[model samples]
Target: MEADEKIEKISSQTLISNSPSKRIRIRPLTKASLVLRGTLVVLVLLTAYTFYTIDVKDVNFVQGMIGTAKNVKVMFLEPHLSHFSFSHALYQVMITLGLAFLTTVFGAIIAVFLSLFAAQNLSSKRVSVVIKGFAAFIRAVPTVLWVLIFAVAAGLGSVAAVIGMTFHSISYLIKAYSESFEELDKGVIEALQASGASWWQIVFQAVIPSSISYMISWTFMRFEINFAVAVAMGAAAGAGGIGFDMFMASSFYYDIREIGAVTYFILVIAILLEVLATQIKKRLKVNI
Candidate 1:
């Protein structure tokens, strides 16, 4: 009788504990919530309307791709295989690589310096605001405009493309580097300062080391962006890179074969850069 009473008491307690409350309440949406929902619905409707009017099927994408493939086959099997020397194509590739290297290196150096001024924790309030504004101004201007400016000032060739890429890349690099620096542990900086380290020493020892992985990742990402810019400006400025060749072929209504070849070359370079960046991230143990 005692054991049964104890079991019944435990079961009753469990049932009581699990029971839901009898109270009921209703919550109404705020004005802000209703406005946000209405805005989102309007935006979705606009997006759908825009998409519907685009006529994406008019070009027959599959047919165009088949045509491109045919051109590739002809270019590879005929004139490219028989008449053209590999050395010519190799030279264009080298030019693109050189341009990319120069712009990325120069831009990264400039960005490192600018980042010091732009970082909120590193610079005075006035300096930080000024630097941020300047960076924003640089970013607001399109690369095409920069290319035009440099082309007129520097007078064409790879020089213009290099300058254009470097100018635009500085803005991107500064923003990325500043953000990375900001993400560093504040406690580490505080400890270093407490130990009587100078600003430079603290930054070099505590901040940079902690943020090196992000720095490298940003640099690689900027390189890819600058490479594309280089290609575009190279063609526009008559810089004799692969882009120049591609543009020339298009201007003369030359066989799509030539255009396809140049495009393939660019695609291959982009793929290689992506693979190399991935490997670097792995080696550095940088988690994105």
Candidate 2:
């Protein structure tokens, strides 16, 4: 009788503890979730405050929209270069390409040597850490800022642009190249070591050959980035390219047609570069 009574009591206790009402309650929210919610709330409050405080009493919304439409029509429908010829624009584009190419080549050469020391599998832990940390710091700063800094010494021109772009590219490529190198198979490295091969021999025989495809891909990607940066540097650093001509048209002359013409040129060139890169990679069968 006592055992039966105890069993009934335990069964009743379990039923109370595991009630449907208790199961319906939510699990505890995590710290990340709480912070995300808080950030959203803060942003919403700030946006509301900004909208409340701004003065738009004198604004003419309809006129502004009509003016914008007219400007767009003028730009796209009628685009012609009044100040510069087509050949000049093409030459300027070539200059920009040259800048990008030079920077990629120089940076890749330097990065290859530096990354050999930065790869953890191939180099000492201390050296790898130092190289990676330094590269990170260099990459933290904007490429434009680096160009301006070099401009202080080299003056604002192609020289400053090339040096600054190359500086940033080296840091970027170091991290990329080192990571690729580190991904090499440990078994291959060990076998080479056991066979009495020197470090350079092992690198040439196994590492470079294995990672060449990836390296080429990374280098080309960097080239594309450098080309865009060079265009911007042309206007900002006085590097003199199609970008400079566009800046002159838009800012000095206030010519929408000229701006549109420059935009078309840049767009066409960019498309050609993409096609070229794709074809080259396909021909070489470079995956990844």
Give lDDT for model 1.
0.81
Per-residue error (Å), model 1, residue 108: 0.4
Per-residue lDDT of 122-163 in model 2, one digit per residue for the tens? 999999999999999999999999999999999999899999
Residue ranges of candidate 1 with Cα displaced over 4 Å: 1-84, 286-288
lDDT of 1 by residue, 1-288 (tens): 999999999999877777775333375678998999999999999999998887776688799899878876876655341223467766887787778888899999999988977888877889988988888898999986887789888888777877887888898899999888888877888898899999999878877888889899999998888778777866787766767767776676575666666777888899999999999999899453
Q: Candidate 1, 228: how far from true, in Å? A: 1.3
RMSD of each: 7.6, 2.4
For model 2, the run of ten residues with the poorest summed lDDT: 20-29
Best by lDDT: 2
Report lDDT per candidate. 0.81, 0.93
State how far residue 194 of model 2 sits from its true place (Å): 1.8
| lDDT score at residue 99, model 1, on the 0-100 scale | 84
- The CA lDDT at 200 in model 1 is 93
In angstroms, give how far residue 68 of model 2 lies from its true place: 3.0
What is residue 134's positional error in candidate 2, in angstroms? 1.2
